[model samples]
Target: MTAQYDNLATLESWNDSFKVSPHELPGERQMRARRVSGFLRARQAELPVVPAQEAASDAASGIADAGRKTAQIEREWVSAQWGLVPRWVKSEKDAKLRAPKLLVALNETVSTTQAFRDAWLAGQRCVIPMQAFYVEDLRGGKPVPTRIARVDGQPMGVAGVWECWKDPQSGAELLSYAILTINANNHALMRRYGHPGSDRRMPVILGEGTYDAWLSARQDKAREFMRAYPANWLLANPVENKKDKKPKGLFD
Candidate 1:
């Protein structure tokens, strides 16, 4: 997939579609690799859930944790860079140079990939809300920008992982995220996009019912929701202009 996409334009849509309050509106509607955009993630207070039996055992042994509580799994919208910056990065300059190449994490190796391993194992999964994602169709011999959205026209909640990095020099924290992609070589629709000979891949689109569940799932169980979105449910339309690759009629 390309390093660009479109996000929710209005506050009401962001609130209704993702069911969270964004502290600030996005300045840009179209997002590129390192742009700051809003994403939904479960509140950290309830993450890494403790099993009921484990909590009960601790309580009986007089070792109950004071901060432990039943899993409420609250979600919040956070403004983070679209490209993930590993917490281990040594410098801010290195982060800027590395963000673009780290835009998408392969689902097959996300758990083991060096750049994403810390965030993945820390249960930093998130949902990226977008109106649609852009790709280039080269079937016609030249690149033609294409807009890929759901057939129903509703917003899509894409699966991703988030991270927070601290500038070792300035001590400022940077929040960022990366979309998780799966092999689309066998997909009937997605296979038509991207480069001609390279392996096909697409973002992991989650179902409406699984948004909260995805954020609450344990690290090991998160992969269960990494299935590809149905090709028939998606609609792809050629953008009018390659340079100004905005969705037709909507932004005008």
Candidate 2:
């Protein structure tokens, strides 16, 4: 979802591409990869035999449903403005809210403050699916926009967290999500384009194999899987700002 604080063109493009239908909400858009050999081998070594059907059903019904059911939940309508007021927030209908943009700086001290600390501590892991995400670069003092996605050209899931808030008056529930960031991995293409620092923060990319563990309410395993993702997995490039005065190509 585009936030109001973001550039209008950026917001419009996001809404147009993502929120096409009335009931359509922005779905997660991160890249997905098959389970790598290492993780698969490790899992196989760890769990040699499948559990009984009944126990397996119970675990899947409980935890597996969390992610899927949560995914089906929708946010209340708000102007595409990024603010602290979570989509799930239902109290104070007209209250003017202010919040940081969803894209957070990982190493910054503010990230460790109350706003994010609780979710992290609570083992609240989330996945932000994105068709694409934007990045800015300066060339001759002009900000250039780049669209980043998977080299294999698939939607990606940036790790995220969801907060459920209750409306003080009616006791209605609201759910909101946020993207997590960490230092970038060293990839040759990202370096060549001067995309940003290898240390520059990026979304916590979750591998497909780990989706179950990450989404599990089991905090310990989820935390262990939250380590930074590999750099070589992402591909990025410049794109035209279609919302601008003239439809310029990436070179512009």
Q: Mind giving the per-residue lDDT tens digits that candidate 1 earns over 26-100?
A: 987899989988689887563455777765554444211312232566788888998999999999899999999
Runs of candidate 2 exceeding 4 Å displacement: 1-96, 100-111, 185-199, 242-252
Error of 1 at 2 (Å): 2.5
For candidate 1, give the lDDT.
0.84
Give the Å shift of residue 154 in candidate 1: 0.6
Count clashing pairs, candidate 2: 21
Runs in model 1 lying further than 4 Å from the true structure: 44-70, 242-252
Record all residue pairs in model 1 with backbone atoms less than 3 Å apart, i.e. clashing. none
What are the models' TM-scores? 0.86, 0.54
Question: What RMSD does model 2 have?
Answer: 11.3
Q: Pick the candidate with the highest lDDT.
A: 1
In order, what lDDT does every prediction score? 0.84, 0.43
